[model samples]
Target chain A: MKSLQEQIAGLDDVLSARLGGTAVSLQPIPGSVPVIQVVIGGREELPIFITASETQVLCICYLWSDEEVRADKRAELLETLLALNPSIPLSAFGRIDKRFVLFGALASDARVEDVAQDVIALSDNALDALEALSAYLV
Target chain B: MSVIGKILTLVRGSAREIGESVVDANATRIYEQEIVDARNAIMKAKSELTGVMAKEMQSAREIERLRKEMIRLENLAVEALDKGEDALAEEVAGKVAACEAELEEQSRAHANYALQVGKLKELIKAAEGKVREHEREVAMARTTESVYRATRSISDNIGATGSKLVSARESLERIKRRHEDLADRMAAAEALDKETSTRGLEQRLAEAGIGGDAERRRATMERIRARQAAAHKDA
Candidate 1:
């Protein structure tokens, strides 16, 4: 069985290449739920993970405090992002604190670069990570 | 002397004169009559004053009662408004307005009721006109309804007669079908009789051996019998 850490690391490598501001690290958050943080678009790398059910990929992101994003607005962004990434099978989505959890599939054909760009577009920044992930997955 | 002072002096003099001698009958009589007359005049003045005060008091009481009633009505209107009972509020408002108008009219109508106001008759006349208009509307509706009912009855009768004719035609077709069925039975009986006769003839012909190898067999038997008899005789 592949460990959650290894899977997260694999996802991080894909996210880093697609997003490309050098991956700061691919380390596990020490807790019941597994989480991997990757740096894209300068300093802040967002956390991504597989949920407890492993039914979907949990992408947790924080809008920088000055960005002042409301949850409903963020949920709208997540919906847009999920729409753009046809490769990912989005199942469920939610917002906690300031982070968003997008539950969906992460397969070999997943468009990581486009997902990264969608994230950047959803944020104030414009970064396309899906393109970098395209070669790695295919 | 001026009128009131003159009357007062005459009254005082009459009182003094009466005190001098009750037995001086003429003077005493004048004094007594004057005193009674003065007392009656004073009493009349007092009664008139009392009447005026009483009327003022009654008017004040009426005004106070009207004020309290108006306050109560206004409060009721407000409460009705708060409850969103605008219709009720308007009804109460109409009543209050009518009461105010009536009060004004009543005030003008009297000093006393026998005194008439011009506006009162006009209001009554307008109200009567409204009632007449409403009655006219009701009568017109009744007339229209009668006409409608008459036309409907006529059409209904025609429709019913037509429907009855359709029903009768349907029944007549059913009877004709029954008659045709009887004819078909009679024709079937005739066909059956012909078939029976033909069958009887065929049975009789078969019994009589008209064909079907029976004649050939009979001829062969006769020849065989003859040959046997000839052989027997020869033997």
Candidate 2:
């Protein structure tokens, strides 16, 4: 079995290969459960936190807070998210600490490049959802 | 005001004001009346064209008559000169000159009349084309307006039906959830009954009577052994 650092290194290699020269890095945050901060793109990098075990790797991107949504428009915003959830391949909407998030998970044995692509795609979808629902946000 | 005074006041209104009021009061009727008036105008223009053509023909005949008259006077002047009548020839020559000038003026008048007739004919043709174009445009406008109204109505119906469909789907989802809950409850109840029922291992063995069967077989075997012993003693 590969150590957690070695697995993260392997993931970093895959991300580098898939994104060409887009600059991807994985930095470990010391904790009870293993956590890695994944930074992709340029100097103003968007960070995605990844938690991994021997069996699965989960990736999460914070989108917005519930407080940003207007009280009257919350229901419409939630409905739009629910309606869009099934169509967003390999990712789903979730709430944590009163903040909306986009997340996806893959088996550790699966292709890291494919999961990285999914993470990028999910991030784009999250940005699009924010733009579409901006009218309902403060 | 009295009815007669009201009537007199209405009669005293300007013709254009009365016409506008009538058109406003009876729009559809006025529209049909306008179509009739337009047709009458076309007929009147056609009659005017015919009258101009008739006047042109009369001017042509007058010109021909003046030309014949000038020729006759020239012939008379030539005959007076041949007969050695100098005064008569001179008088005829003067009449011939006067007739030539009159013919020139009449020819000019005839040309002007012909030009007017041609212009009037062209005007009538143009007016006819305009009338037909206007009729086609009005008809197309009416059809387009009707189509627009129908499309709006269909969109309204779709909006109404869309809401109904959404509510129906929500109701179906609710019913499905309730059915699943009821099925889970029934399954749980059946499992509970099986767990609490009093049929245990000893009760099932007693129902089969295994202990009674073993006692009967042992008694039969002992009797058979006793009979064998008695026969041996007697022998």
Candidate topping TM-score = 2
DockQ for all models, in order? 0.00, 0.01
Every candidate's CA RMSD: 49.4, 30.3
TM-score for each of the candidates: 0.22, 0.34
**Tens digits of lDDT, candidate 1, B4-100:** 4433343344333422321244643554565555555545545554565466556556656766777789899999999999999999998788768
Per-residue lDDT value at A138 in model 1: 13
Misplaced by over 4 Å in model 2 are A1-3, A43-45, A53-55, B1-235
Residue A93 error, candidate 1, Å: 5.9
Q: Give model 1's DockQ, 2 decimals.
A: 0.00
Worst 10 residues of 1 chain A by lDDT: A129-138
The residue-level lDDT of candidate 1 at B55 comes to 61
TM-score of chain B of each: 0.30, 0.48
The sequence of per-residue lDDT tens digits that candidate 2 reaches over residues B168-220 is 22333443566578789999999887776644544565567555555677788
